[model samples]
Target: MANSLILSYLPRGSVVHKLTGTTKLIVFLLFSVATMVTYDTRVLVVFLVMSLAIFKISRVHYRDVKLILWMAFVFLLLNNLFVYLFKPEYGVEIYQSRTLLVQLIGPYTITAQQLFYHLNMTLKVVVVIPLALVFILCTDPSEFAASLASIGVSYRIGYAVALALRYIPDVQRDYHNINQAQQARGVDISGKDKLMDRLKGSANILLPLILGSLNRIEVISNAMELRGFGKNKRRTWYAKRPFATRDRVVLILGAVIAIGSLIFTFWDGSRYYNPFI
Candidate 1:
């Protein structure tokens, strides 16, 4: 999808990109679930390191994820801030200990336990995002759908996903073209305009973007119908590939990592590894 951070692919020859789409998808799922289930600082740190290493191996640059990273940073900061504001002592309750970090205004006091909790939350995000980005940016939409179908998902669902991913860039390109056309017609969407003016200028682009999107959807629907889509219970994929040894290795590794993370993190009968204990 056009400007999507985790649904658009960039064609590359990197090893990460060479992996089968299903394998990448498996890795993404396994790592994401593992990260979500564990609150162990050590586990999170290991995942963080592994994520960074994977990103490096994928040859992903800061520029590739620049906007996504900024958005995630803003979101995480706001989430942490609100958590502290509303439930600053939640960490203490969970960990069954309290160590004051600072005495803030009113009911808003900071504690090491809460900070650690927030740190783990942040680490969880860091550990999952790169995997998602890599899976999205490295996998081709058609190949992804084919891989999905190969994994026993219905071809109809797989085709729908492929189309959705493929259309994101189109929608984005349409938005940009419409914006530029409106700007040429004397709309002030440029940064030189005041913030409010720029915000309001979006009004000029919304109508055209929506109309363009609807028109594109109609065209795609017609084309799909003409091609006899969804007419059969089974379908063959043009982009499907037989799994390679590397694919098997990746899948096995992902499963092992996920299971290992779960076992180790919950070995003490708690979702969180309480360092204070």
Candidate 2:
């Protein structure tokens, strides 16, 4: 359950957990937009600090989100590499200057401009990813569905989202159980095995897991049908929550940050702040 915290809620009593789910979702949306749309290093640095602070406030341990963050780090690294490979001169064009660092193959020379651009690009993800993980970790799926409904989204869609979030942990638990059962039966899926053999063994585990998931899905669908789900124009949420003062404050802060990002990024008629000049 702890290992599955990335996609499942922790049900903690942290300040982040107490806020309405809608508020967190809105803040995530606004925060993501604010960070992504601006390239001001000062702005991005501040956003990064704020995001880290929020993650700490959420009280989710580093271990709870380490896998997701590490995965993002790998992806971010690859993205930067691919960008440089495809467009080595993109930063030079954007910044309108080039301070050469190393001359590599033909057009693949490393430059100060490119590194600066990539640094800002990486910072955007560094800021947003943790905040997103915090939101998912702290908010209960049922309350999140209710929050979605409160925001004028369809209740059916909200319920579906909640079910998806709930199912991640269920699938994880199922996988662990099945793995243990198979391992006890002498099936070697351990890392000691050759990579190919381990993959082959995994297929055996995957087939049963998939079948179990299908069975669970069928059961859930039948239960929903029996309860006349989707028959009403609007359904009520079991964990419906209203926005309190704290939630309002969070919402307003996100809005202000988003608006401020727009102003800072576009005030000079460009999306970047070039301190290199």
Clashing pairs in 2: none
* lDDT string, candidate 1, 2-90, tens digits: 33433458876888988988888878888999999999999999999999888888877777778888888998999988888889899
RMSD of each: 2.1, 1.3
In model 2, the runs with Cα more than 4 Å from the true position are: none
Backbone clashes in model 1, listed as residue pairs: 1-168, 1-169, 2-168, 2-169
Worst 10 residues of 2 by lDDT: 1-10
Best by TM-score, which number?
2
Model 1 spans > 4 angstroms off: 1-7
Q: What are the TM-scores, per candidate, against the unseen true structure?
A: 0.93, 0.96
